[model samples]
Target chain A: MAPSRPYQPLLLRLLHGLNSIFVIGAIITGFWTYDTYDGRWGRLPLPQFKEIESIHGTFGLYALLLLPIFALYAFRRGQRRLIQPDTLAKLTQVGKPIWWYTLHRITNTVMLLALTFAVFSGKMMSEKWLPQGEFDHTWYYLHLIAWAVMILCISVHLLMSARVGGVSLLLSILDLKFRPQDSPALWSGHIRNWLSQRFKGTPK
Target chain B: MKQNLALTIIEIIVFISIIAAWIIPLLPKLEPEPNTGSLILSAPGAVWLIPVAAKQNS
Candidate 1:
């Protein structure tokens, strides 16, 4: 049999790359901010650091802003293809992982919104915002809630991925020969279908 | 049943770790703030430091 072609879609790859960079940025910056403002709270106290905190917040803001674009893409196109039974089966060898896919979409959407809220609220509380005292309690509560939601969603996402195939599935994004034997043409075809459907009426 | 139990345990552990990370700090605590000037470090700063150090070493 011919070697099964790589299955990752270009758009998926792009979104995954963007999301990875932004999330890593958010994590590093978040830790820095914690170190600066609330290191006492962390189990492993990170040294107080501020220089990157701004960068972290900035990346987080970008991530938050990009989320709506991601969501719009997901809801309009990615959702249909990703949730297809054949796709899920090919991806996980499981029959329609509906719960997982739904949770994934919902969590991702919520995470982006939460991140946005957290960043805005945090900025309000920061020295950057004028009349900073106006935002203290409300900002603090919103930031805390948003962080909590993002953390929980991420944990669920990781755990679900692990359950499907441990680290291999997670790493498969980078592995070229990531597709299973049964469905060789699915990924690229899905992307083409998505683009065509999306641009059907628009001018070339 | 066994697999379900194992998954449950793992879930519980993750949940506990998250809770502990948040709760432990609330308990009474005091420590001197480290001098920020002596060690100028930030989140992404560590990434740059390594390459610079490697260049200097080379």
Candidate 2:
């Protein structure tokens, strides 16, 4: 028999899919905004559009809104995907599969941190600054740096996932067929149980 | 131990590079700009809730 295809939880797929859409949108629009405004680094040959900043800000706002929810899910349900205490030790295994997996986890964690910095720095910026020829804002510079780091982190994330689990793992996140237990109908109850568990030992 | 040391060194370099990227630009003294309205309603699907005018001003 052929090997069974991997499955992902519906909620992970939904959140990841939406977050990816918004983040990627922000990334592309962010570049356009850069090209249009502060091309001190270099300018693309593409046409410049001043309104791209507003569009980029819109995508960034959406990404910012989705970030907390995605981060909560990542920390709570998908904790294994992030770096663990033993990750450093695992990285020492150099050529081993475990090493690649450890690197993948590190990349995942870095991606989360990079996105947080990008959005938080972006939130600190005023839309008027770019249009008004004011680009020296510390927050704006930090946001640009965050954008660069996010790109690098995302690249490493894809490379590490491909190295560790191959194409199957990459496809799993987009998989639509989920087990009954992972159904959306049970989400409320699951959340309630998780909340209760968290508060179980707390003072009344 | 050699491999571990090598990996540790690389990690340290990467961490320092990121920190440098963040800090180097801010080292120069720059004047802080005063406040302006933020892009709170800039995102798609967001509504702008215009505050009601004061009764006396109206």
Candidate 3:
């Protein structure tokens, strides 16, 4: 019999879904904006709409707003998906499953950094710069670099996940199944329990 | 032991890179144009106040 698919936390699925939508939206719009305004290296034949930048900015704004919450969850609750003290050590074990897992963790961590920098550099930029035909701003350059890194990191993240866990793992993240403990209705109680445990120095 | 040292190095590099990214923006006095008169404080902006604006406020 086939093994049962792993279930992800309901909150993780929700946040990950929303975050992916905004991030992908931002990426596509970002490319359109780049092609529209500052295609200094090579220009695409796509139609130029001055409004693409505004659309991209909106996507970026949503992403920026959601990032901290997602990051907190990732760093606090989903810590295993990120780099640990042994991650680098595991990298030396070439051709092993742990190496792939370590690489995946590293990729996840880097993706976070990539997203942070992309949002930051994009934020620092003036909306007027591109409209005015000016593209020499340092933040603009950094944003471009961040975009490239994000794309590469995201691609690697996907590949690494597929490598480590195969297709079932990828499908598992999208699965809506959750345990009673992971229910959204219970989230507030969980938070309260955590807080009480923290302040009162007692187990929940 | 070598692997552990390498891990430390990577951690240091990542930490330094984040710090440098934060600090480099300050060097240029980069501030988003205020919408009205008061600065439009955003979540990211609040995390790192514009160096020039902070200097003026202080």
Among all candidates shown, the one with the greatest TM-score: 3
lDDT by residue (tens digit), candidate 1, B1-58: 1133432343344344334433443444333225422222233213112234544665
Pairwise TM-score winner, candidates 1 and 2: 2
lDDT of each: 0.53, 0.77, 0.80
Instruction: Find the candidate with the highest DockQ and give its number.
Output: 3
Which residue pairs in candidate 2 have backbone atoms (N, alpha carbon, C) closer than 3 angstroms, thus clashing?
Answer: none
Tens digits of per-residue lDDT for model 1, A80-152: 4323334333445334666565445445444544554555555444434222323246665666566666677
Q: Cα miss at A51, model 3 (Å)?
A: 1.0
- Cα displacement (angstroms), candidate 3, residue B56, comes to 22
Q: How would you encode candidate 3's per-residue C-alpha lDDT over A1-204 as one tens digit per residue?
A: 988776778888899989999999999999999999888889889899999999999999898778777876886678778778787678899999998899898898888778888887887788999999889889899999988998998899889989988998888889877887777899988889888987999956
| DockQ-derived CAPRI band for the predicted complex in model 2 | incorrect
TM-score of each candidate structure, all chains considered together:
0.52, 0.76, 0.78
Show the lowest summed lDDT stretch of 10 residues, model 3 chain A. A71-80
Residues A119-179 of candidate 2 have per-residue lDDT tens digits of 8778767798998999999999999998899889888988998898889989999888889
Tell me how candidate 3 scores on lDDT.
Answer: 0.80
Error of 1 at A17 (Å): 1.9
In order, the TM-score of chain B in each prediction is 0.43, 0.43, 0.42
DockQ of every candidate? 0.02, 0.05, 0.10
